[model samples]
Target: MIVDAWFTVQQIDEATYAISEYGHWEKVHSFLLLGTKKAALIDTGLGIDSIKRITNQLTDLPITVLTTHVHSDHIGSHGEFDSLCVHEAEEDWLISGIKGLSIDIIRKNIGRDITLPTPASFNPETFTPFQGKPTGLLKDGGEIELGERTLTIIHTPGHSPGHICLFDKSTGYLFTGDLLYDETPVYAFYPTTNPADLVASWERISSLKGIYKIYGSHNTLGLEPSLLNEVKIAVRYLRENDLAKFGTGIHRFSGFSVQF
Candidate 1:
């Protein structure tokens, strides 16, 4: 394994790697999935450092950055990649900046709660989230073929209008993005989020068959597929009690929790 001052690289398989920033409070994780002809990078980490440095060491194939969402933390290093693809719902936000989200809040969130030394280039005061056009737009059910491997895009919105989850059909690996994760509450209480849609998304992913493992963008590196069962129960509970709305506080399930 390659050692770095930042970014912990873990091998999930010979063709897949999890690039994580455990030092950051969010514990953001970016994935590198290698195919025979190309590679797919799922969301860059916080712009505390250049994630391209790690990707370069992982593969020589052309990298296609598949953004799970346009959140500041997820797209921090988006500018470092040339071929970027985001959901059609977030295409405008990608070209422009996420509306109503203040740079001050972003800077504050990115700068604080750090346990590791950040790169000198990272200046939260002046730190700007990557904003530009995407090479293409992806939609729900859209399939991306990286040589022999195929990633199916799931439009699991609610956390954000354009938030998505990627499913690796061949490996049965589901990259849930921010839509699902353990530890901290999955956020849907923000003005931009829709709690109802979030529950629906949880139901959608929970119903997905043959998921071997779940890879969320933050906190834990991987979750067992059995957690999907818990998600199903949580979704039913949230919808049954009519609690899938903002200001509902935190709803804890057996394996995960959500705030709406």
Candidate 2:
């Protein structure tokens, strides 16, 4: 029987691809970090109902979902996973709901105002229904075993202090959340966004060796190996706006290098 998978494995390695509910916001591509027996889903998309449509296509294998940060688009379906993992720093944000300003940014990015209904368990007075919950807290170097494989949680703060990247050192695959993207990274964000820390994250990531390929939480799966280098393009854009702010040269992520 043919089961249409929500994620397609990258032809080159232990990587899987899926699109976020927000298709036009280009940086919204999510990924599956697969080991031999189990897989880790990185970043859920903007809309929970849409997440069900995408996840319904996934394998019956037990899956654990994690978010790079608590932004609404990245953690919309947090409750779907048996256990949801997020950086400790974002725990409050997840429980309280994402920043009000980011939603407006998303609306502008998507070119429309999409108001999602709250989940039944939520109280409209203090809580939002559509916003999901985080079940576990993760930190840098934290490891999770999915069957025979182990994925390392690299805390690459900046985009958000708790922002994380999943690295499969064995396969050289890094699931970079918004901290590194193929588009203009938005440094001017609400709640918490430190361009300096983000630049440091680039330096930290550049040290990884044997990184066969890189994936983004947003729209960047089709990035041919060659195009993956465009993270520098993002850094350059950020630099033009304020080079001195980052404390050093821009750090970019192409498939081969994270330029700083």
CA lDDT of each prediction against the hidden true structure: 0.94, 0.61
Residue range 16-92, candidate 2, lDDT tens digits? 54554332334366666556677677876654344544555555566778778877667655666676888999887
| Top-TM-score candidate index | 1
Which parts of model 2 have CA positions greater than 4 angstroms off?
1-15, 20-22, 99-132, 186-191, 222-260
* Candidate 1 lDDT, 1-260, residue by residue in tens: 98999899999999999999998899999999999999999999898999999999989999999999999989989999999999999999988997888999999999999988888898889999899999999999999999999999999999999999999999999999999999999999988899999999999999999999999999989999999999999988988999999998999988799998
> Would you estimate the TM-scores of all the predictions?
0.99, 0.72
Measured over all alpha carbons after superposition, the RMSD of each candidate to the real structure, in angstroms, is: 0.6, 6.0
- The top-ranked prediction according to lDDT is 1
Relative to the true structure, candidate 1 reaches a TM of 0.99
Task: Record all residue pairs in model 1 with backbone atoms less than 3 Å apart, i.e. clashing.
Answer: none
